[model samples]
Target: MKRLFRILIIGLSTLALAACSQIATDANSLFVSELTEKEDAILSIASDKSFVFDFHIDSEYKEASVWIEKYEAGKLVDDRLAHLTTEVEQSGSIIVTLSENTNENNNSFNIGVGTDENLTSINVSDTDLIGLESMASVWGSTSEKVAIDNGEAVLANISYSDDENGMHSLTTDFFEDAAGHMNELEKYDVAYLLKVEFVK
Candidate 1:
């Protein structure tokens, strides 16, 4: 009876090993082999306005999706901005509209997604305020541009204070861009940042 019990123990151990191996294989199958290639297709927008943009992609079980968000004055504005769910046949896309809030001399805007899942691309366009016009020259600098590119998932922490305030009539124009970088991958994820500052 002791020898039979030993044999049963060995059998159970072998079965456990097999189950673990199967689980690993299943996990590996969920990832796409060429994720970065598709991630690079996303285009970068110039950071010359008051809005910032960020984008990223994530995958599971051979399926992938994208997430995007935006902010203003250190506060989240786009809570349900956009999303894309990837599949075998076709990928899905989500687009969000921006709402404007005008209250006396203080105008505000917002953009973002409520979910933490991966996102394919995110684009943000805001009117160029007078406060950002003076900083236009700085936008062409490489370092500032790099900062904008890397600030997508963060608040961008960019702001300017006014000393003398008297009806600062602000005006801006809308900008547009897109990304199809993750199309070639079967599974993958990528993230990016975009920043725009307005000057007068």
Candidate 2:
């Protein structure tokens, strides 16, 4: 019986070690591979008379043109929205949209972008109670541009204050190799998305 028990323990130990080794070897591919750019869009609009322009792209956008027209007295008054050019990431897609927010007899336009789960969000505060409110953005080299509402405080050093709401995150191929994995990380085809609603 003693010999049998020893053998059983040794077998279990070997199996556990092998499982761990396999997990370590496969972790890189399982979590980091097959990433492709899915979206990227950037639109710059210029106009007078303070008119609001709202645009939204559900998926990847190709080369496109933007036109804004002004009207007066039931006729075309001016169509001088010019000097516009579109520059998009060669592989990724970013959806952009605009909406109206009314607050205390005031009007503002809200911009919204879509997002994914791969984002590395850091919770600054650990509590059910909420804290101060402010607007902030967290950015990194590989990370896509993200916007957030009032929640966690952004430190001057770009770190973070507490793990709270409104805290932003990072996502990209930068993390795969940076974490000391075997596979090299490359820019994913899918770009991060941004969306929000606030009284302006």
Candidate 3:
């Protein structure tokens, strides 16, 4: 009888521990891609797609900053894609949207970042698009051109946790580039940082 009682207690303890472990994992879930260790890697996303990052900034953090950048040859080319700063605690999703050039009336791609109803935008003209196309030779990806020509987009998303080991989007396989080119991201320590890149 005592042996059976001990076995039941052990089983219950194991089940309780598993439930707690699952809760912790679900609470701290972040995006991690297979190419996370590679450098100068890009994620090819279709046009008209949006990447949404849900975040909650602790009040201990006085401020929050968000921005988007473009890289070539492991160097940052454009740093002003979308930028936002907030003084109060922000708890919402940071959305990055990519819109293709469908008509000659608007032969430009607009990269927009929004939190709820507030939004910030940047306009990339055809001339800028051509410049991006020329940089593709360095990556040696012919498909990159096809994607770019088809108005596809690429973004590097990075998230920083309390552990100080940041999490990055699947496409930004290059930890070196993400680490080196923080571009003022380090200034404002964010609990969760999502760096977006739009290529069209």
Best of the two (2, 3) by lDDT: 3
Report model 3's TM-score to 2 decimal places.
0.39
Return the clash pairs for model 3, or none: 38-174, 154-197, 155-197
Name model 3 segments beyond 4 Å from true.
1-47, 88-90, 102-127, 131-177, 180-200
Question: Which 10 consecutive positions of candidate 3 have the poorest summed lDDT?
Answer: 136-145
Tens-digit lDDT track of model 1 for 1-200: 22332232233223333333443232111111111222222111111122222212223223333333334332445543344343311111122222222223222222222212222233333443344322211111011111212212222222333323311111111111212321211111111122222111
Clashes of each: 29, 24, 3
190 in model 1: Cα distance from truth in Å? 21
Please provide TM-scores, in order, for all candidate models, with all chains considered together.
Answer: 0.23, 0.18, 0.39
Q: Which stretches of candidate 2 lie over 4 Å from their true place?
A: 1-60, 89-200
lDDT of 2 by residue, 1-200 (tens): 22332332233333333333444332111111111121111112211001111122223432222222222212333342121224321111122222112122111122111112111111111121122122232323323222212211111111122334544334344332223421221121111112222111
Evaluate all candidate structures by whole-model CA lDDT and list the values in order. 0.25, 0.22, 0.32
User: Which is the better candidate, 1 or 3, if ranked by TM-score?
Assistant: 3
* Cα lDDT, model 3, residue 172: 36
TM-score of 1: 0.23
